[model samples]
Target: MALKETRRPSIFWLMAWVCFGLLGGSVKFRVAHPERIPERGAFVIAPNHYSEIDPVIVGMMLYRLGRIPRFLTKASLFKIPVVGWFLRRSGQVPVERAGSAAAKGPSPLAAAREIARAERIVVVYPEGTLTRDPDMWPMRGKNGAARIALEQGIPVIPVAHWGTQALMGRYAKKINLLRRHPIDFAIGKPVDLSEFEGKPIDQHLLADATEKIMGAITAELEKLRGDKAPAHRWDPSLHGQSETGRIEP
Candidate 1:
């Protein structure tokens, strides 16, 4: 099933599709269980983030599935001139630091409310940034995706993709697109949060929900890559690595 388009594609999205379409020609997108995405309405997509190019791949994959894609973009990007104009016009949500309530940007719930105002897919990286895993496994999830879902009463769909690291390493400054890349996206069903339906939003509850969301995505990634993930998800705090910036593992 494909997501139902509720509105016409804006000029930015139209151009974005054409641009990403050309980029996709050089990279093969092998999608599995795309039917997991709902045919209508706004829903959160929780995907593992390992490479800087991951967002492009996810956006391309969603558009291929008949859905217009949006993202929780960094607030700094919105401060730029031309790129910011495109991002705002394209309807991407802006956040200071995703999933952080104390951060000095727009509220996370406000981002969710904005997402609910439309019918597009919002791709959220629960890890908040590139994974610090030495092997690029999914790391500990932030509460942004879960907090958004719970605040706005939307589904959190767990998705995972592999092979982008081969296109470009985690902290590498260069991206090699000379060779055709085969990237696989495994879209899992919406994570069930029935247990937390009426509970007051709290740090404990958000952490648990984030765990389930990340677990579902990790499971999907394991299936796509056919490799077992680490027994414990990587935590930057434990490894003395900065949480929001590049850290070689």
Candidate 2:
């Protein structure tokens, strides 16, 4: 069941559909639990981050699930000339790498507000960037996704995926198309935030909600990888690693 018309322009919708479609054909996708995607209304699709190509892979998966996905991408990526122009025009939201709305929008509340206004499936990386874990397991999450869902009264859908790293390794500059990498995606039920409902939206509440979202994603990932995640989630601060860049230990 495809979603109703997207808020993005027809041209961009077609462009992204074609671009990601070609990329999608290059890789073999094994998806589980596609039914978890919401058929109606606006919702957040939170996924684990591991590779540079994840956005393309996840966007294609969501589109196939019948929702045209809009991403919460870093502001810096939106500054790269033609790429930036396309990002802005394609209806993607520009967010500060520091985890706030971009300066152009100028309000902490502005990004989520615009996303809610669009009423489309918005993909937010709870970690805010590629995973810093040595094993590429999910690390501690940023509160952006939770903030959007809680403030906008929308649900956050957790998704776990694997094999993008094989298609293009973490921090790799080139995608290997010589062989078809089998990528897997598993969508989980929307995180239950009923307990946090009506609470003061503070750092603590947002962190807790973000963990809930991450946990849901990790759980689905375990199904694909057939193993358990580490008992402790990787903490960038504890490891003295930068949150937004490649940090070599």
Please give the CA lDDT of all the candidate structures: 0.82, 0.82
Q: Model 2 over residues 1-249: C-alpha lDDT tens digits?
A: 565655535656775667665675678878888988877778888899999889988987777777777877667788898889878777787766454444454342466568777776788888888899898889999888898899889999899999998888988889887777899998888899998989999999998898888899889988989999999999999977877778662
Q: How big is the positional error of residue 37 in model 2, measured in Å on the Cα after superposition?
A: 1.0
Give per-residue CA lDDT, model 1, range 24-127, as digits (tens).
Answer: 55788888988887878889989899889888778877777777778878787888998888888887878776455437677656776687767556777889
The stretch of ten residues in a row with the least summed lDDT in candidate 1 is 1-10
In model 2, what is the error at residue 70, expressed in angstroms? 1.0
Cα RMSD (Å) between model 1 and the true structure?
A: 2.6
Q: What is the overall TM-score of model 2 with all chains considered together?
A: 0.90
Query: Which pairs clash in model 2?
Result: none
What lDDT does candidate 1 reach at residue 88?
85
Task: Evaluate residue 181 in candidate 1 and report its C-alpha lDDT on the 0 to 100 scale.
Answer: 88
Clashes (candidate 1): 0
lDDT value, residue 225 of candidate 2 = 92
